[model samples]
Target: MNTKLKHLVRKIRKNSTAAENILWKELRNKRQGSTFRKQHSFPSYVVAFYCYEKRIIVEIDDQIRTPRSLYNHAREKQLTREGFIILRFTNVEICRDLESVMKKIREKL
Candidate 1:
């Protein structure tokens, strides 16, 4: 990764959302079979969580700005085309239905 992206990743990691922290607690320590990296930075973009063995990226979709929706849609399409499986969870979804989220992730794995 480039120096700028690396720095951005560090900043993001340090300033995680409450939902991210809650999910991280469950996803850490290889509890789901393989280790997951939080705030992982790739050449294309930075992901909230990633598991290399499962080729899955988990994103907390709390923000709902319309201006970025088109861009996010394109990014999602490109990531899928490149063979990456993405799991998106809203803040409410994670906070209220964590078990269901974990179940879905386990199924993906």
Candidate 2:
């Protein structure tokens, strides 16, 4: 792993939020033959979850006020340009129905 990625992994391990912890529990140990790193950063961006081998980035959003749709669009565009396939899900969605989310992730992989 890169030095920056190491730092990011440390940060994630130390301070994962509830949603991150839940998802990590399900995705850890390369359960699908693909390893994932949390709080992975790339340039000016920090993704909630990243699977480098699969070129997949998953972001868990809990937007209560500001509409994140527009910003998400731009972010996805930027990531797409860099050859990343982005996936977004709401906190509620992930917490309430993690199986569905995991299924979606498996499909993407």
Cα lDDT of all candidates, in order? 0.86, 0.82
lDDT by residue for model 1 (13-94), tens: 9888889999999899999988899988778788889999888988888764232377668877888898999998888889
Stretches of candidate 2 off by over 4 Å are: 1-15, 64-70
lDDT, residue 109, candidate 1? 90
The segments of candidate 1 whose C-alpha lies over 4 angstroms from its true place after superposition are 64-68
Worst 10 residues of 2 by lDDT: 63-72
State every prediction's TM-score relative to the real structure. Answer: 0.91, 0.79
Evaluated at residue 98, the lDDT of candidate 1 is 97
| Prediction 1 global C-alpha lDDT | 0.86
Query: By summed lDDT, which 10 consecutive residues of candidate 1 come out lowest?
Result: 63-72
Give per-residue CA lDDT, model 2, range 25-108, as digits (tens): 877889867999878777766788899998999888775423367867788899999899988887787899999999999999
